[model samples]
Target: MTHHNDGVTTMPPTAAAAQAHRRTLLKAGLFGAASMAAGLRAPAVRAQAKRFAGVTINGAAFQHSFHAALKSWLPELEDKTGLKVNFELQSFPIYNQRMDLELSTHGSAYDFCNIGTPYAGRWITSGWMTQLDEFAHNANLTAADWEPGDFARGPLAILSDANGHIFGFPWVAGAIVMGIARSDLLEKAKLPIPATLDELVQTCLRTNAPGKTYAFVNDQLHHWEWPPYLMNEGGTIFRQPPTDLMPMLNTPQAIKAAEIYTQLLSSKCAPPGVLSYTDDQSQRMQLAGRANIRTASIDWLVPLAKLKDSKVRSTVRYAPLPKGPGGSFPGVNANGFGIPVGAKNKEAAWTFIQWALSKASFERMALQKAYVTVPRRSIIATPQFKEAMTINGQDVGQLYIDTVDAPGVSDYMKYRNMAVFPQVGEKINIAISQIISGQANAKTALDQAESAAIADIRKAGVKL
Candidate 1:
């Protein structure tokens, strides 16, 4: 018998191994007929119960929250669906590289994967993912609570193509473009919440104290961090459809956004060496009270409310990114559950996906603060969810949701990490680095990047 990604192969299982597997399932309350008697919705369970009993569903997900949720909820999935799930989790960078390799070469290894929206375009174009339109509407398979409409539109739109081929179901619908601040610092400084981009910059400058605390920090290397500011200023990295994308990185709005973004470091408002900070490093500064404002994912900061060793644990507050000159458009990012085209146990994989993303399961994770930006409306409306988003006794879940669902809020994935986008972004990242390092001004750096980006895109000759 060959050992596959899911650990189950075509060869027959030995009696002892089979018996052990059954005992494990039985312990999880997945025994045939007995599960129905336990008051677990029999109708829903009966139709698919043990239908893929001996099947092993392999899964791959990112290491942080997604993997955490999987580890905490896999037992429930096994008990409910009677499908053995074997999951592999890797750190962010490693997972991105590995998943790309697996999808491009060894798609059969994992039945399904938790795919970030940014990579959706790459996977879809490769013809590596199965279209799930029929599986979702199949009444016999989908649970009653799995309403497609329940997903926030921002997330749903990103997961689908122009023709509305939904390649995946949203699992993490978060606005990584929101702002979080230290409430205590703001109060002590006698400053009010910033309502616009200029005000945010001013707030950062005013609150900053050299060698003691800085006012702002963001993950600048990822490239997408520029969107919240750029889009809000009515600028974009590119214009027109992806296939015919025209680089607009050096436009008036873009230059202004870039000037302001890099100014934080140049003006000494952000900590020194901010150019080297990743998402974790940026947030660590805030957690340690070395910075007063952070423009990043709210999902990353919500768990800090419970961190015992953190200085700002009880003082942190969630806020929408300040409105820009044109308007306020926070950038929303998402991750979804996708089935590989070569998955042998796709049916079993779908079953596990349904169970894992169900309302009950989501609520369980929400109580544990596993996710702050929930995908489902039912989970968002729950009291437990409200509690999870509470800061200083204020339930701010609605604020976070509104930010994520805001109009014109750029869905980073909707741009679809096309082959060209990454190329364009790489140039822009270099340009940003040059500006931040004081080696070039915004216009000069971006002008060079823009020309190079256009050339690269044209060279790719990607057709829509």
Candidate 2:
């Protein structure tokens, strides 16, 4: 096997080389507990069994709990399938770019890949990925075994192209646009934590002060946070679904949301260099007492609590997104694994995916030191997981549970020019930056963004 990255490719482990590596891993004690926890009984040594050649999978390489769990199970997979699998981790920002480039060139670089739900539609439609419905059915992986609500019809529908063919399995599924705050800070401030957008704005104004902690800071990049704010206000960047050709980016509600965000920035309610901050920066700022409130993924809370800094450890809390005029509108995003089209070893790739997603493995992974929320319904309801959350002082695990169960707004490729939402997000980011920098008013900035996005979407050949 060979692994390639950044124009460099290197030979991966051979069958004999991998067998030796597996023995070393066993000696170092990486697989014993996971195997036992999953009730995976070791087989008697076979006399020179057929060796399935190795495969490489590409996915986001961040230090997320899901990746850690997958790492824990890799050794066991090697033992069972006789397939040496290599994982190439990329940052989320570059993950899609790399995957698209590989697919476009028809490079046999990855047998499987982890794709976000938003991009899955494009991949399926473009024929970059295989239809997994039959494969999943053959493997006896029923939707019933997984969290029905997490992969409910509404959300799962977004994971398909116009033809309604499923392209990926729900891996680490959850709504990402929500708030995590220092509950202890709100208690100290003698203020009730806001549950509505109006209240949230007031709280920010009241709690913000230079040289003192500000109340709220959000990631200003082209990502999940601002989209929910628009959704909550009953507004959307585009008038139709999936394609970006006919954008309503300058809707009144959108301008209102942008104005509020601009006020927060101008009032210094956010940290210095806030515009340069991404999701991690916002989370770190809140965890370090630089800000009291932040909008981020619910999955982030568990890791944030485990931070070495005592301030964040003792103070953090999680909550659903504040209600907007449209009610408690929140944006949903999903990440999961998919088989790439033309994979050389499709069966072996599916075997690894099935093993990683089995109920047994899900339970073991969720209970790891870092509390990763698995998408399996059975795993979330387990008493052990509940107790773990309680012990870690994170009682809001149920909030995540309930949030995932609820209906949410999903991004599909069909609405604006196919797969243009990310580009729309960039326009929104630029507009917000202009508003905050005082180079343009909220209405003016959003108007320009709306016009530019519409033009771009039209040029992409998507009909409104």
Candidate 3:
């Protein structure tokens, strides 16, 4: 026998015929063992593909910072599940329009869709979403570390039905805290951040400079922006939402809240066309330092410090929505993904959602993209997250955690959980507009709103 560069013994064919014949059986045994290991490794790789390779998860939601951030991480999801994802992120108005239509018709256009906080009640109770308890509890589908308890109770309640079964998981948190866009302006005037409702008004009036910079800026979404002010002034949309289905829009407390809102806007404390401002417009004015104060969700406030284009990065200060006679309240809302009741791919859709809302996913979003809007308390409690979310040495993540926990004491935001709130909130939008424009007095406008809201609630079959 001769050993060559081939690393195997080679022999003259005639001389080593006997030896080669003898080794054939031994070689076959070795080959079988090697093939078995490779076969095991190959199936593991193939198993990933076999799970969901040809499937494409169709989902959609209003364009949000979290959705935008998730786009960059799609490869991780697609790779792990061996599936393609075709999630369409539309503008807020467009998404809402399409979603309402889909819900009404029971269309299966999306495997999963965003459950807007205001619409959660209507969607869940109407049987438009799939119950997630099965997928969440199944050991084969969901890994144990998902920890449903990590979500804030307020947000989870928003997504659960009357029976307390979960249908959606929160991914977008709307923790409405106050942002001082021009702290330099507040400090130059020797004013501290307002601690009470009265101080907020006086501070805005003192800081008013309409020609150069507006003192206050609130977007056209009165349903979202105006409620905090109304609630702070001891007003409520319903007597007690989800329990007492009565409309309380015309109460003394509500009129008082309206008057406060009207005065703040009509005194030239706001921009000339403030009511026409969209969220993007209002946020732009704040980030450009043309607005002194903005009360909005953390999603918008964080941009004041983190965005490269922010003119007020160094000057912005964060605070809870100021206290009033009723109480100190900060608005919290959420948007999360859920499978449509009409969807065909419920299991695969959850596979995406489970990984999407996983602890690992949240950690990457917060640490890499500074997405503080995640409602998972566990992620927010991390030192790494706190460090990443800190801007100019401020623990902004702490403010989010506090705002989330604020309503846990009494569930003040329960009003938003009623299915008819969106309909009722539209009436409020018109009332506030009329009051601000002098088309009607606060009480008259509010009374008209109360009548309209009652009609809406009744139409939705809510008993009064």
Candidate 4:
């Protein structure tokens, strides 16, 4: 409404002038009312679009595909939320060692970090990571569609405490599955994909050559690779993980698995430097057609068929890690982002995490980067995504889901969830190296490992 002023002069004031002043007062009153109404409808932070304008989130994590995909959208995150991010990516080992020191000292150098499954238990129990329940459930901070329930339960359980306090939002959840780089070798040998332990050994022997193309390859992290074999042989790491907490490394089952895994490496089925091959090296070996089979997460194996640089792209095939009489237990793990308890900018870091692990972001990373190990059921269940992950007539997406749904994954993974597992796991690796080098047989090596693990666990203050 507009007010018109009459051009008439009077002794005191004209009616038009009085009316104009009343109109101005009415407008002011209405404006205040509208402002209040808007405030009631929207969060204050939303009202101020640049609320965190000067905030900077210093994040630190290991170099991973999910982080690599996320960095591509850093500028977009800043523009959307007025938060600047200085994210540092390091190798897995370097990040773990440095983060351990930072957490132990309560340093606040990083606002957010990659909380891997193996370290999450120790970090969470130590109170190094911020409890994310407050931030995740905050209506004003978290969006309605953020859907904390969308995360796969198995992987999400890894990041949650007994009281159901979630510490991280997952980005990479992977299950160990077999990738055959030489279908031609299987075809020539006239054998189907190996489905049992005995068959795996036989298949490996049939396809293995003394030199040139190797029959099998595994990463240097034998603690991770060997556990499934142990479980398959009815062996276990603990008497009962998270309960008894006893070291069972010297059990008969463990010795059998150790013998089998060491045989794979020591019998010349794997490369000369199989004991030293990192995860990247193992993947490259299969991609270059130098390794006949590789058992790892879809994150690494899928690249053999999808990455343009792969020499085995046309010959690669996918299968679950071969099952055995004791039952198959493929390794499953997730890496997620969480705010450090010492972080000065916890809220801003949480904002970045929610955005990075948002459903939309998962889709974009999967579709755009061809990343296959996302732990969201909604995306993984979609027909388009299923189609996107299919390779060479193999439903690798379904294989991933099956691997996650495997019963042993949840029951057996509790062993790895113990805070002292890393130390004990290192002992397992050392013992395996001893067996491979002929310093000890399987039983002797594992007996030494159990002794060392008991000492380490007790030193870590675990009752057993």
Q: After superposition, how far is residue 442 of candidate 3 from its true place, in Å?
A: 0.9
lDDT of 4: 0.84
> What does candidate 2's lDDT look like per residue over 1-464, in tens digits?
33356667555458787787568767656566776755543332341252453444433333456776687668777766566677767666577777877766656667777866456656666788777777777635443454333353333545556555677666675555344456666676787878877777787787875666777776765445676677778776667564324777788899888877677666557777777777777777777777777766666555566667636666666667887886665555566677888677676677666666677776777665445556565667778877766624656556666655564433432442147776677788899899888899999999899888877767777666
Which scores better on lDDT, 3 or 4?
4
Highest-scoring model, lDDT: 4
Candidate 2 shows a clash count of 10
Tens digits of per-residue lDDT, candidate 4, 106-191, equal: 89999999987689888887899999989988999999998887887656767766455898878888788889998888999899
Query: What RMSD does model 2 have?
Result: 13.0
lDDT of each: 0.74, 0.65, 0.82, 0.84
Candidate 1 backbone clash number = 0
As a whole number from 0 to 100, the lDDT of residue 53 in candidate 4 is 73
Candidate 2 lDDT: 0.65
TM-scores for candidates 1 onward, in order: 0.84, 0.80, 0.87, 0.87
Off by over 4 Å in 1: 1-49, 177-180, 407-413, 417-419
lDDT of 3 by residue, 1-464 (tens): 54579879865577367578558747876888789888888856785656886688788988876788777778777777676778899988789878978977788888989996778888887888899988888989888888787888767767887667998999877878888889999999999999887788889999999787788888877877777788888877788767887888888888887877777777568988887888789899999999888888878888898889999999988988887798866777878889999998988899889878888888888877777787898988898988877877788888888887655522677777777888888999999999888899999999899999888888888789
Clashes by residue pair, model 2: 241-415, 242-414, 242-415, 242-416, 243-414, 243-415, 243-416, 243-417, 244-416, 244-417
